[model samples]
Target: MRNLRQKQASLVHRPIAWHVTHWSHDVYSQGAYSTLLPGGSPAHRAALGDCLDGRLVIAGEACNPKAPAMVHGAWDDGIRAANLAVRAGARRVIVIGAGCAGLGAARHLSAQGIDCVVLEARERIGGRTHSLQLGPVTVDVGAAWLQQFGDNAVAREAERLGVRLVGTDFSQPLAAASDGPVDGIEAAWEALRRGIDRRLPLTEGVARYLAGLAPAEARATRYAIEGNLIIEACLPLAELSVDSLDEEGVGNDDHFLPGGYRQVIDHLAAGLDIRLGQPVARIDWQGSDVRVNDALGDFCICTVPLGVLKTLQFVPELPQPQRDALAHLGMGRLEKVVLQFDRRWWPRSPTGYLRWYDTPASWVEWLDLTDAVGTPTVAGLIAADAVERQFSGRSDEEIALAARDALQAWACAVEAVR
Candidate 1:
């Protein structure tokens, strides 16, 4: 028994909170990989295999079959596309979208003495992986954490570039509230794994699957278990597919970049012919020549996001299978609220993450930034449809108040439990 009654009087040590709204089209929508809908990775395969008349090449995390939706996947795919372009006897290549994939391809092409240009829609280098300066410390607003540092491409790159990584404790929840700890969380987790092992081709969503097991009798306990799953999937429990969840697979030694993910972008974008604020509307490709917007190239590599690609038109419209694949793939919405405080108020726990069961699914996980940056700042992540449904219409102040209230309730609950 620990002394939980030693909670601070005020829930928040600081009144400043930064609400960053990441739209589906601009930053990201379909995070990492698509939900294993009816026809899962087949669509991804079709898109990757079907390159417009051999003149246009598709490269991005989505095109990667083994590791889709990962930064390293996108990087590797760019190199793969670059190799394809070179094999096709292309002297010059124009890479669309200066994201990780696009920048990666350009870097490889440039190294091979192949002329290439990177066109980005935004004025910045990183697309979704943006590092924002919050108060005295700088934190990554998007794509902050990296799983399995050992043998991981992104991790290797970070290490080679001299970026620091802080390990995270995912074994236990840092804090739980209002429901007196909901003691059966671990058992519920084990039940989920058992259910997964038993019913393999689980076409159903996680919500119904877990409900059948009746892992945790308490509603709060169930929420805590599901909340963690929801954050990982970045989708609502009902919308998430069990097959996709199983296929994604987990990594070991999860770590966060205390120096931010922007370092990776900077390292990848060194000395490349990058053109910013270039929103390509159309791509016209014939036998040996391809035109991106207005630029001409022997071959073109398209690396724009699925959300952005959905809006753009290809001259010889993509094949039926490719169109179907794009239609079936969905974008995962995420909302982050980062707060900086003057003093550290939360207890120092080995588990770096916190979850509140009573709160709506929208505001579920909070990552403590105190250890990483030596500042009393915390980031609250809200994923799935919850971002648009719960926090879209609300103002920053309202969202901040709701979050503060939730934290207060959790703190008060901990005190009561002790």
Candidate 2:
């Protein structure tokens, strides 16, 4: 058997990076689950959460047209459902799926002196807001950060719960796989911004749109484009929508709760009845009466995921248009890979986000978790279509190996700059 020293020596000399490191992957089937595929357009939103015969009301991020796939969107939908329930004279509310949206609805209804029963298919609440143990430290597996402070429900709840938050550094730190760190990448980024400013109605995607610009051939420009368009948006350049870019008004004040996002889940779960391990099979509703198994109520609010709801049985069947909307609106695929290292191998910069321009895979943007989690850890968040093609069916080991190899290349590239 090779000793640790021998193993370390072999790894160093294997044309990889410096010292060998051991890492573990914690993968979830619906990890960072978001509906990013087709469906859920404006036409679909009309029936997404509409009350059917004043007996069934749908809720969740899927119902939110303004901010789908966001925790805040789900939270807001819960509030809307609570109001709808009160207006409909619901004696007791049945909230399906104890996710952020469901819990939010239950919590608000409870506060309003209304009664609600929340049924969760999974054993725990906080649907996508899952936090898991990674080696020695704990990290969020889903819904990690509060995007902004301005009127953000997540941030407000965090403050109320007294959950301390650490602001994530969004400063750009650019590096290329073949050329290492590009020292003057910001200048190129500013030039690209100038070009973007000049192009008013950008119909095409960022990658092609930038390519049409004069100086897009510069290596630094591509780095900037990858970091800004691809990595930041979590989508490929071609798929990123330039039209909705201006619609985002939330200033860059994103933060992560070090105490774990589960704290938020616990806070929202207080004083609410949540039945765990109870998978809802079907919804039978008519004329202000809803039933799921023996759990009967005057009205039902479905906070279940679109993906999960699509598979469930609905009695009397929903309208064809509603079915079509549910069929078309897709769940966007967003996955995260977290690796805990023995020590910090990458450069210690104030930059929070690092992007590798030359990497073809989705592990392009890496979030350094050393400062936040107090571990020599890094988490890679991939949101491009390539994620589905590359990582969908692969096991945790396969994905981790891919991540390790990518990190190996990235470390070598960053090390060369030093």
Candidate 3:
């Protein structure tokens, strides 16, 4: 048999700087985003956010059905929760988990002449929308992209906040792997997916759509599936629901925050009462007023991520539907490893994604952030089982090495084609 060493041959060029995230291991997030199970329903998200006892509500990306697992969704849900609190005659409100949702809720509640305070377990605000300074530039380590930017609320917010954004064009074709000559692929892919059997997983749906694709088209379709869909879902396709394929965000433009996404977080957090380093241990909500830790409020909005919510203690336990919502959904891991070399070494691509389809492990997808972040940097994205293996205690330098090896493999493949 051919030696498996060929599968992950290492490159000699060492990176000067590196950053990797283990959102799953994070005590705050637990995982990067909410995972849509094979046969999950948006109703479950509704159930999760359902207001209880007219004094408690859950708010987060997981609570927004139209746009779950999105930063704007969390922010929007927080605002929605704040409105609900106002309508319910809440005098004072306590918002849990100072993420986009919490900050958004606090901002809205404070504006509405209501007394509100936000409790955060982390030392800083922004939560999942985090940024880190690397060399001379600031890049987002948490939620980075302003997806579907044209109508994205965060995109508009970025503009008002003066945060710089660089557009991503994935179809530039220089760095991406095979799966060529598939015209109308996006519309075609969506059309075929519209009637996917609901009982089965997304893998089955993809299989049905790819039943008799041409050799070239099949390759490209698989690349798109593995590089785009799988990466977005943050789970192996088999674990995703066919329904996930049915939904698409309204717009198409995806932009990176050149100055980092924290600009939005900082803007929303301004003029709000937020308490940091206060982890909520239990919520006692059986009385007329809800009690979260030592803070009590006429109403409470819990914006905790779904992964953390599963283990959080609630007094009298959540209703059956909410508990069932927690049981039905799952959290999928998506992490990034940033590798900055002394100089640009790999083949250049238009500012977008470089997907190496030859091997779908480690760095299956890479975002060329050189132009976006103004440094010789590339962000390698890994998901699903890759997350488990990396976070099991792998160091950032080791992850950088593995990512560099994948870049070597991609370079070799590109040379062969030329």
Candidate 4:
């Protein structure tokens, strides 16, 4: 036992406490967010949001073409679904999947004197936007950043709730305790992508681009692409489209709600009729009235994630457009690991990002939350193949060990280089 303990200690240092998100394995979520496949277009997203038979509407982040995979988009689409349901003469609504979208729909419908019943699979209402009190400070295990702050309703709600929104300048990442290089590689990517057929899956296109390069240069560029672009897409390059690069880009500044992002979801859910631990086994939309389990309503707005929606049983089936959209659109995996130390083990300044380009690249980029939460915490994200390869089937302790080892190895490499 003593030798085993010593071996473990030598392998890696441990944090006081840690949390990891197994989103892909979650039956309710099945994925972190939505993404377009090789042939899917933005119109597919619009199609997914379309009202079915004027009595049923599918609304969620995946449905919002303007900003799919965003909290504001999910919230906005939920409100949109509610308005459409009212227009269709719905006085009572059954909102499925008590996520941001369901909460948004319920909030809108209830305000308009429409009776709304929200059924959530999980005990929590936030869905993938859950918040947890890790150690001394709160950490968002799901969605954290308030993107496109200027037009984001989520951000606006945060401010109204008196939550502090801290601006993050991602351009100034603290790498090795110094401002890292900010060479926007769009120019290089364009040169590589210039003549390649855009319809090819991102991997094929990337392969063709890298094929001509020398071995070392190709490896370095590939590493950058994996760390930056692949991480952004949250899916394997083979499943992702070349358009992902353009589709994933967000304009305007993103703010971090250090006060906890769950506040916005809670505010949206306040005073609403939400039933937790009630998963809709089936949604029968065969007639004018849609039935969700024991509850039946004139209209049902399903905000269940695309990942879950694919597995959900809908009687008589959804429309061709919705079915087609679901077929073409894909869900992307994004998993997070939050490590809280007894004290700050990293820098407090820059407070944005710390990236490591080492081999394996499992926990390559991390968000420094030490400054935001006033606690010594760092969150690292792994997506796509990294999630499946390194994290799947691994125990939480083992995953935590992997991350600590990666960080330890990175620090040692930096010191050796110095």
Query: What is the full ranking by TM-score, best candidate first?
Result: 4, 3, 1, 2
Residue 309 error for model 4, in Å?
0.2
Query: Tens digits of per-residue lDDT for model 4 on 167-196?
Result: 877655544311222233434455555645
- Report model 4's TM-score to 2 decimal places: 0.91
- In candidate 4, residue 176 scores what lDDT? 36
- The C-alpha local distance difference test score for the whole of candidate 1 amounts to 0.69
Best by TM-score: 4
> Per-residue lDDT for 114-163 in model 2, tens only?
87899888787888778877766678877777875565797898898788
Which of the two, 1 or 2, has more TM-score? 1
Put the candidates in lDDT order, highest first.
4, 3, 1, 2
lDDT value for model 4: 0.79
Choose the strongest candidate by lDDT: 4
lDDT of each: 0.69, 0.66, 0.77, 0.79
- lDDT of prediction 3: 0.77
Q: Which stretches of candidate 3 lie over 4 Å from their true place?
A: 1-11, 171-196, 203-221, 249-251, 389-393
The TM-score obtained by model 2 is 0.79
Model 1 quality (TM-score): 0.87
lDDT at 334 for candidate 1? 65
